[model samples]
Target chain A: MRPAAAPKAIVALSAAVAAPVHAHLVETGFGAFYDGIAHVAVTPADLIVVVALALLAGQRGTRAARYAVFALPVAWLAGGMIGARWPSAAALPLLTTLSFALAGALVALNAKVRDVGVAALAITAGVLHGLVNGATMAPAGAGALALGGAVSAIFFLTAILSAEVTALPVGWPRIVVRVAGSWIAATGLLMLGWLARSAP
Target chain B: MKTQMKRWKQYAALGAAMLVLAPATALAHREAGQAAGFLSGLAHPVSGLDHVVAMIAVGLWGAVLGPPAIWVLPVAFPVVMALGGLMGLLGFPLPGVEIGIAVSAIVLGAMVLAQLRPPLWVAAALVAFFAIFHGHAHGRELPEGTSALLYSLGFVIATGLLHLVGILLGEAHRWSAGRQTVRAAGGGVALAGLFFLWRAVA
Candidate 1:
């Protein structure tokens, strides 16, 4: 058992290092690079929430729950693509609405689950979303990419934390997801309002 | 015991009938350029307190009506709504549609809570009427082509799911509390509609 486990640890370490390189694939310009750094500096609270979701995602295996687990990353990927394409203030609400609605749909679809695989996928997807966003924030060129890599790692850890907390289902988990969803909707609304003003 | 069970059955049937019979009412208008997916998935219920309440109320009523109502009422809503949406997209008018949508919530909520028992066709007719407004709002605001279809699909799916959720909640509180909670929610929705009306007209 010890001999077998040793290689597992080594492999895990190797894969972990490789993950960051693959994660921070987005390129940034000089203008937005500083803004990314500023956002990182100012928003410690966002980081905390990301961490919490990750921990919660670590637990649970219900189909809707699992889809919700993946929602953020899916939103992130989609958002990044949209953001890349538009790169204008006017596009933010559209992106936000698109992201959140997608998340809600994924969460609503109650599917049957097999086992741990669901949990694992949910955790991966959740972290991927945070990392992708964080990467986008990094400074232009090499600096931006490097900072994004670091943020992605932090995001991954946070996802683990979210999954961990979510594991402990005290009686009802669906209700929790609904409650969480309500909050997500509220946040989306606020973002929508801000985007509307900013664009006009 | 059989008589008591039958009485309970009758009450259940009445509850179900009211949802189907709710007078035509509508709520929450969709905007032009809105995505079909977003309109159907998110906006339908979220746009107004009344829509949220009535949609769920319809579902709960169906559950009380029995298994057939469970599927039938929800199915009826989307199908009717789609037709209405098409009319709107085609530039056909649903007069006083906004008001109708709001009233749908107010009247349906009261009916369900008050346990009003109308004849079956009357109930179906009312729901069908309101569904037009709901569907028109959906179709009127849609973009051209695939997006519109997707948006309509989203709303229909969301509406169906809302009904399912209402049923589950109603089942959960099989006792009086769940039913009452729904009733209270209905009242609140009506009150909010009054506020919305004031805002719209004033």
Candidate 2:
């Protein structure tokens, strides 16, 4: 009896240990939307580009800035929809990084562009970013996740742009913005190097 | 003057809260039930000293580098880390994973201690490369039935929060004495890395 009881206890322990681990923050329902937002929010690469572009747009004046505010989300959603239809390309990361680097450099140099140019830049950024978002989205509820990503992007871009626009034109603030742009360029170059080194 | 002092006090309290909440062990455990997804993902990074140290070091290095680096390093880390996680999930093999992880602590800590501000891109590359090792560890150890998406979200958020803490601490650089304190923290991290390296090699 004692020997049989020992085996039963061991079996129970093994069974307990074998139970599947839980991993999702939200396992069902609207959790998917939260998951989508979480995905975008956690992605530093995307956020930086969005902020950098917004800053550049704001610097260009109200029209480019307003266009950015509208164009980015629309382009992002369209890009996501397109990405859902096509396989993710290896070049996408490179393109995104380059876009970021370019944006950063423009900001650093305080370069001015036509409003159309800024709009194009915003659109390109949106599409690239949206494509990445779409690629990661679960197929079953891709739309919900995309909506979340759009919402986050819009909110983030608006807040940053508004702050930049409202802040008084102080010497140090301008310097900080330029410094941020330089940093973006440097980071982008580094990523490109890493990509080059790791490429097969 | 009173308000300034109060602000300092608030920051101090927040720091205290951070220290109190900081996880103590470096062992990963699989959660058995409903607590698994986000909680488990969040636990993964803080559970391991190597992960925590390297991550905090990234933030510290970022702060030291200033401006864009403060943002770039943190951002690049997670995106590249996700790629690494995907590779792990696909069963791709990366050699010297443990060594790479231990070395991350040593290298990142040393960067902080020496105040090595490389070109921003170079720094970002360094942070991104090491992130893969950490992400792989998280991915490989993902529980049997958890949603990979949620788990990824949890860990990313957890990792970002840790970076934020390091960034806040790195803000000590604004003052003269605070710079030394931040560097001292870096030294402590480096020494801990050495210990981890020894344990790994042994």
Candidate 3:
């Protein structure tokens, strides 16, 4: 190629192959943090688990609710770090659905599980879904910063939902929580049917 | 002036009742993508006369039954309906889904009209039984290639809202005049259900 055309060719190639450069870059056109927040907002599967766990913990009482607030985001961050490094979440959706479904069922039943049980559930759901989120964001080079944003979002969502549910009066209000749980479980079951029907 | 205001109030109430009674294709829409699926799902449960009446009957009957039954029936309906939806999704083939749905309207509406207080367990069982038919029909009728999750969410939310409407209407049972009004509504629902049943059979 002629020397005059070589610069143009290089510039064109750079544009075509431009990576979401993170090294020495504080922010791209849209920041990674916002990207992470938006990701969780749109993902219903994760939201359901977060909601189910919050409702379950709150139903269990103040102690369980408090434990869940801490366990959920911490476990999610830890799991996310590992998943970002590994970056494979291809087969996670099925397990994710089942996790939320079971959590919802437990909430609906108003199970008399101990505080530890709620903590365990929170941790399990946090790690499982966080792994998927991490795997998704890592490929876009969001890494720890994006994961931190997501963890914050999860933290807030779990905190508010559990706290509100904890404060609710018993009887009719409590019954409303169970009704929400039933709806969540029903959605999961329907999704399961869809997944099973469409699986290749 | 007072008489004119009273007449206007009556006209407005009548207009509202007519709007509610009209099942202007509450369920049917074919649109692509997730948002569309949500809208479509939201409309699904209210689309048909048969579904709307039966769902309202569930709530109305619950109101008649009172207390735990009020919450229990509504809670159980979605779960059971989704089970039926699953069956439809998997091609499990429950026979007479349409007939069952029509019958649900007929029977549940009749129960509301009579204000019959059966045992709680029996009430729950009947509600659950009817829910299966509703769910199966919904599942089978789900639009192909739409976002299943959004659609399901919207559909469930709509169904719950309809039950809420019934429950609200049932709240009329608190007073003597209100009780008569509620009973009258139930009778109207039963008549609608009968029409639907005839249509289904024919």
Candidate 4:
């Protein structure tokens, strides 16, 4: 079916976005700490998402999903240009939130959600995850691409893995996704609290 | 099997081609206000950790947001941001500009974590204000005697690509097991914003 095409498209996109990102991340003056976190923690997760999405959607969804995934990096470029030229407070955050939330929503809508409650939870968790990552970029050179690429890779991989198990028993899929969402939500809460306390 | 391998080779070639063309166009710089020069303006975002993280993150988030949001939000950012940059170059003083930019990181992070649903105008206003600081940076840093068109083009293209990174990452949350990991990563970014806030004031 059409859903099967998602994963393939994501993989293709990953390949396209990764090259420049890699060069940019490697160029960071901050040394290897941020790079290591991005590459190890973030990138693998992104790649896994692609694999899961591909598995779930199979061959049919590839074209659409591929383009969908490919569009992320392109949007990154455009956003950078905006910030470079304008650099306003309100516009920056607004664009940042909308962009990340929309992408997460797209993936959720395309895939099957066994329960509406769980789906909402998953979506909310996804937004939290995306927001935090968006708030902390390297700012200069091609570093944005590099950092963004690392995070993108993580989500792509996750999509791939989710897609892989699409055919598993329905209950099983929901349970797995729910559990993951719970952990993510908890982490977000922790970060939120920490940030609030730390802020003056 | 032979056919599969052949297809793989073709894909590989395409990938290679994309890689070659990627660097020049694929990279993004910070919106450094209305700098008078080329390299300095371009170098603004790269100079500070705060601007770099939030700018790229905005692009990445746009990528995650899906098609219309991705396209509209990213498009709106640069267009508006450029306006903000113009204001800065003209010596329009925005009070608490630095603090506001830092606050944008905090607020944006909370919005993502909270999944707040605000009106479209709200989003526009938030981005518009933040763009001023970013634009100012560019204006202050841009090299003198550079073609404004070329400099703008260079930065705009780079900025869009940054949003693409966020979109892809946000989309990654769809995977089964990886959802938590992605969320955790987002949380990490928010935490980093806290660090930047401290740095800005210190």
Candidate 5:
């Protein structure tokens, strides 16, 4: 009876130690939220689109800026919800690439777009981006991911908006912004080619 | 108090020893089998300093050349590289392949440092020539029993992405200070190339 009791105690102690290790392997709650933020930060294609869109909105002035700050996040969340429900959309990457290309080109041209047009672009960009994000995010972490993504998007937009309003320099600095637009466009085009080549 | 200090010193020494031994113990077990397939191929170019620097130099040179060169060099490289890869797969000998790769970094980095704008064709040819060595190295490393097509796709995409990063950095040439910055980066690449060259020879 004593020997059997000792074995049982050892087994219980081992189980207690292993439980936390297993929990660490499967991230939940705030860990998942941080994962979502990291996911967006690491994706170059996603980052280029966000920066280009924000820059374009800012270039179109305060009204467009105001519309983008509000519209993009709301539309992104809506799109994420749609994607979570139906995850099999094969066209999201291509659509995302195309939208990014168009946005970059528009920015490079410094096109004068209306506030309504900016809002429309914002919605399209947000939805496409959120769809991709949602498709990749694990089901168990969907809520956390959405929260993190929304927070990141807001942070990025606010930063870009501030730069556009206050810090963007004149002459060469302005040209640098345009050049960045071109680079973004080039990246999009390259990715498009890559996808086409890799397509089964 | 003296005894406590001695005890703390002993603990510190033990902790330092553990820190030194930690990395060796962690890396003691290498998985026995070769990693095969697309993921392995994708990882190959990134794993080698020689491959990464040369590929990036190609993009930097292209961006320095501007316009058609920017587009043309990148396009020409993989096509020519595929030919080299074929040679490698066929077991055709290319001697000093590692040396050639290191030299590519040197020459290409020098070109960037000097802001040399060779004719578009010349630039394309230079990149294509170096690409062969890089591609052959990759092709030779294709793991046994892996799908060649998938492996080729993986390396090509990885190589292209590296070129894109270089191009983005090269775009710094749009500003005056940016031009200086890019040249400074070129100098750094050249120094790195020299180091790799030294290692290859030694």
Candidate 6:
């Protein structure tokens, strides 16, 4: 076969060759919405941050928990919107990691952050993460509905986890939550190390 | 046409080289999912007798110290150890990681054996200091290709559980005879630590 024709043949054959990848936006054939959910579920770093933020807010009190449950999803969606429109990026390798690391550290410390402070943190984490998630979809125009799916997932998780944590009686249950925070913090630091070691 | 032939020759040579070197880069990914990642992480630390004894000793010592110290020591060690792990991953030089691990075992075990209740801060600092070495070793020696997040989670969880076991063993401290038994166990751990320390140095 001629070289040009060979290239054409390969392109045609590629239709049947499918493989899953760790790319930002993954299409699950279940539509854009499920894809969005899958995106968050598969991404451990994002999941960790989501959980950490909830734990931190819950530790802070009911007021903070309310702020996180509302603020985070909204902020994430807003960031995703900007990211989808934004273009030409390198990597923001550490942004989410830094966010989670800081959040986890606060949870471990059981810091004296107020509800407003917790809300601000949720916004910041949500936006930064949402922007990155949005960037993944921008090139393909992966749609706002997909981002909505992800936001809803985060919102539900925040609502459920923070509520559970907030309602715990004030003794060893609180201590256990703090212990979990320490574990999350340790995981974050380890992740940071892995990134640094793997960085060129 | 002659240039085309040379290109073909180069392509053939490259293909041959790739065939020859493929095995060097190929790794086993058969057991490469999340379960494998977590299980390995959980197993690796406990596999090492040195790490296990020390971790359990912290719990035992905590039980002896009673209440807050019991929880506090276990909590602090992992966090500090994680920092050490970060340093290790970043290629920071930490002299005597192995030695430090061994000494941690000896010191913590001795504390359990003697039922010494040093100030909480002193005990915590000592445990934290030893934790760095353990964390560095863990960070430095992560499996080449695995789910790092799950692996770390498994590791931390395993460490926590081991500490719980020690705390449980120390529960014997509730009774005078049981307290003696716990101290005897501590002495045994300390002796084992000495063996490990000798192995490390020798």
Model 6 regions more than 4 Å off:
A1-30, A87-90, A137-142, B1-35
Residue A18, candidate 6: Cα error in Å is 13
Where model 5 places Cα greater than 4 Å from the true spot, the runs are A1-29, A144-155, A158-167, B1-202
Looking at candidate 4, what is the lDDT of residue B180?
Answer: 54
Model 2 lDDT, residue A64, Cα: 81
**Model 1, which residues run further than 4 Å from truth?**
A1-200, B1-45, B143-146
lDDT of 1 by residue, B70-178 (tens): 4556656655665675566555767877777777776666666665556555666777787777666643453343233235445555666676787776564466877
Off by over 4 Å in 4: A1-200, B1-43, B63-67, B117-119
Clashes of each: 31, 4, 2, 131, 0, 0
Best by TM-score: 6
How far in Å is the alpha carbon of B67 misplaced in model 2?
1.6
- The DockQ-based CAPRI class assigned to model 4 is incorrect
Native-to-model Cα distance after best TM-score fit, residue A182 in candidate 1, in Å: 28
lDDT of 5 by residue, A1-200 (tens): 45336445544444444221110112325566665565555455566677777877777777787788777777776777776667676247678877877887677667888989988998998888777666555343456454465546555664566357435665545555555555455445444544554467
- Across B1-202, the per-residue lDDT of candidate 3 in tens digits comes to 9976776576566556554554443321212367877788898887887888999999998998898888888988988999999998888888888889988988888898999999999999999998999999885566766778778888888888888899989998999999999988889888988898788889
Per-residue lDDT of candidate 6, residues B1-202 (tens digit) = 9977776676566556545544343332212456767788899779999999999999999999998898899899888888998999898999988889989888898999888988989999999999999999875566666787778778888888898899899989999999999999899889988998899999
All candidates in order of DockQ, best leading: 6, 3, 2, 5, 4, 1
* Per-model CA lDDT versus the true structure: 0.49, 0.69, 0.82, 0.45, 0.67, 0.83
lDDT of 4 by residue, B104-190 (tens): 666555554544446656665676567666655553334555433335434544454455565666666567455454455455566
CAPRI quality level assigned to candidate 3 from its DockQ score = incorrect
Per-residue C-alpha lDDT of model 3 across residues A1-200, encoded as one tens digit per residue: 75446445545554454344322212335777765665567667777789999999889999999999999999999888878778664347777788888888888778898999999989988888888777766765676877887788888999999999999998888998998888888888888888888788
Error of 2 at A81 (Å): 15
Runs off by more than 4 Å, candidate 2: A1-200, B1-35
Interface RMSD after interface superposition, model 6: 8.9
Ranking by lDDT: 6, 3, 2, 5, 1, 4
Which lDDT value does model 4 have at A143? 42
Say which prediction, candidate 4 or candidate 6, comes out ahead on lDDT.
6
On lDDT, the leading prediction is 6
Q: What is the TM-score of candidate 5?
A: 0.46
